[model samples]
Target: MICDQLNDGYDLVEPQAPAMLESLRAFGYNIQTAIADLIDNSISAGAKNVWLLFYWDGSESYVSIMDDGKGMTEEELVNAMRLGSRNPLDEREPNDLGRFGLGLKTASFSQCRRLTVCTKTVNQNSVTRRWDLDYVSQTREWRLLRSAALNSEDRLSCLDKVQSGTVVLWEGMDRLVGETKTDDSKTHKRFLEIIEDVENHLAMVFHRFLGRKNNLQIWINDRLVKPWDPFLTNEKATQWLPEENLYFREDKVVIQPYVLPHHSKVDQLTYEQAAGANGWNAQQGFYVYRNQRMLVAGDWLGLGLQRDEHCKLARIQVDLPNSMDSDWSIDVKKSRARPPAFLREDFKRIAKLTRGRATDIYRYRGKVIARKSSASYLFTWLKKVKHGKVFYVINPDHPLVKEALNIPIEYREVIKALLRLIEETVPVQQIWLDSAESLDKQSQPFEGEPSREMIEVMSQVYKALIKSGLSIIEARKRLTTMEPFQYFEELVNRLGE
Candidate 1:
């Protein structure tokens, strides 16, 4: 359908080298994600071990990531350094984590002005290539340096010990350590803190790889990094919901929801650790992964669900294949993902189920504790329906209700009327909205009261039953069956003592 005249008139206008390269640096990658991009290449090259070393010298600081992966040759290294070397539309290998083939260059330039890559293949000579932004700016052309900057030979020596591997060196860290002196302890401390941040990010993003047995290893500054499993699947009390497979076209997305146990079910230290890096409240939602590499963590994905406290323990794992990258809208930085329109409804349905289970766990933690005992269940308020209208009725058989009924006949009618009025004026809709807004603000039955208050009430019911000619054993048994008191088995045990 091309017109001959228009096709012949079109002129060739290439992007200015300096301007495009500078613009490529603004891909919104922080220190952690930039390093992760390099690691992705190592993994694709079949590296089992990856080591990250950060040497702090303030503005002179340098960071290098070395991996024992299949290294590229001299010519391959040059092409890898080229921008847009691989097309996003090209079909990649099954294990390839890259899409646009721009991660190594863009990720490096985002953090530093100097990027040097040293690599060697099996029984082959080592080759090194450098991309200096300053030099490129001066020349205004596509240029690759033959050697790394002076004094970096020692740092690059570590790669020589291995048979075949690649080492990515980042220097002239303008964004990270600009113009700070080596003696500045404050800046030095801040640089060290960034290392900690990077460590945490890797632990989360590559948790699947780190947790695999003999799969992959990542170390930061000689310390082994452990994977942080969001599901807490190892705990005995963690609820593993049924796994589901959702399909769209030819691709399949696997989803598994987990409802973590309440704090009472686990030790204090485990509970604190389970809160994750962002704490429990912020860490609740779907975790989207592509090729076992996490892209979106602790996100609701605009699924019309708020991060409510009651559902904080809910975490769902979603697995996506790399082939669906464009469909999911995965960004180059690998920090964001959006489900395609066709799959949003399915995601919402699964989210609702998981949140329901988590809310049940949060609200009924006491009920779970009570299940261990053989005591009969009791509730002070009974739900009743009459003439198709639903409402609550106070249980007349409850110990407190019986005691109030035993008052002088003159007051019994007034007491009954007051209970009826309370039922009629129940703020159902208001309470529902308030609970949705802030579940933490809702109080549990007899919450925060002194233990003595519960004990006193238990004692009153125990004595009343005993006066009616019941033995001590029968009185204690009756107390165990009483409403509210059933939730406090220990206080019920202390009765009549």
Candidate 2:
């Protein structure tokens, strides 16, 4: 594998500039992520305030990100605009939010055909550099434009207000606004929507930075953006599980699980706000952060776990040092990460525990579950783990299950088969998607508007308990402890009154 043996025989070949630059635009950056990549550079440059201005001129619309960071020199600005400004293998500063070093060019080109950067130092005048895809295509060379495309002066004016900072302008936005005319209202609305998405993304990704008092401030068209805290840690009802630190090659990964309060516990607005960008179900999994910057949000990291309504409140925070980026397979877009094989077992264990706690809160209607249940309290369904896989089994000891089993021998098989089918064919993935789409629409057990049906069922269960040789008081108490009945404590108290 040594390079010394083949160095003399190697041939010098370089990639074609025009083709290479065009291909760089295919790195799969959406408007939100592309904007985030540019913000990372602003943060790395030690910016106190970052402003994103969206100018809508229909087909002529442009977007610019200006930051009061330590602006680079003219030579450094040109290098920063290069495709590969820094080696990925080289050790980066602890605070540097970049790797592969192509975020500026690649992210810009992914959204627009033209990219321009104007920077200034405290002691020097401003300087500008640009990359125009049209110029590159026409000349078929690695050409860096000395002047920006349209509205360059107005775009650079943002930096003039600050002593030293950098401003990134995106013009020729073919991928975004396209060829729509200035009077196109539909396209203008879509453009504003994109700006809103960028604002939300920046609020979440740079939340840790924005939360700090006097650290960093982000503005969208001059309006301040508030940080979106995923864990709702400030809420009094939020359950902060024990934090665990796992090791991978001498580096530490901090894992902290949080269980949000049930809807009944929190007000409707607070509960809705805590759902995050993708809603409660999609935002239930692990949130991976690197150097306080979020990389992967609400993902299971390929672990064998499905997002379920019963566990939607469980969100885990995973903090990884930048040094372990390669081990975690951090992508250039910084939107995905895969846990190492050795760490998957640990993640699975933590996930199981958190999911169990969340289910308890969900099923018990915001009440804390007891570690040990009373013998008289019956469970209709039980979870069984076999061969490291989970399966739900109907409890034969339950009054209804036992009564159903007392039917004719031939009917018993049919009942058992039906229960098995229901357990095995649980619509896990569908439930996850439905919960994400409208969590409030997914009703809790017997939570519908008609209370008569639930009352009748509860009365029937009470009668069954009474037939099993339980005293009236004992039956009533047991009914209060049962699954869905536990939530309807007042109804259980008035049963048979």
Q: Pick the candidate with the highest TM-score.
A: 1
Candidate 1, 148-192: lDDT as tens digits: 999887889999778899999999999988999999988898898
- For every model shown, what is its TM-score relative to the native structure? 0.76, 0.75
lDDT of 2 by residue, 205-305 (tens): 98999999999999999899999998887776777766779987788999988888887778898888888888999999899998999998888888999
> Which regions of candidate 2 deviate over 4 angstroms?
1-8, 366-479, 482-497
Pairs of residues at least 3 apart in sequence or in different chains that clash in candidate 2: none
Off by over 4 Å in 1: 1-8, 366-497
lDDT of 1: 0.85
Local distance difference test scores for all models: 0.85, 0.84
Task: State the local distance difference test value for candidate 2.
Answer: 0.84
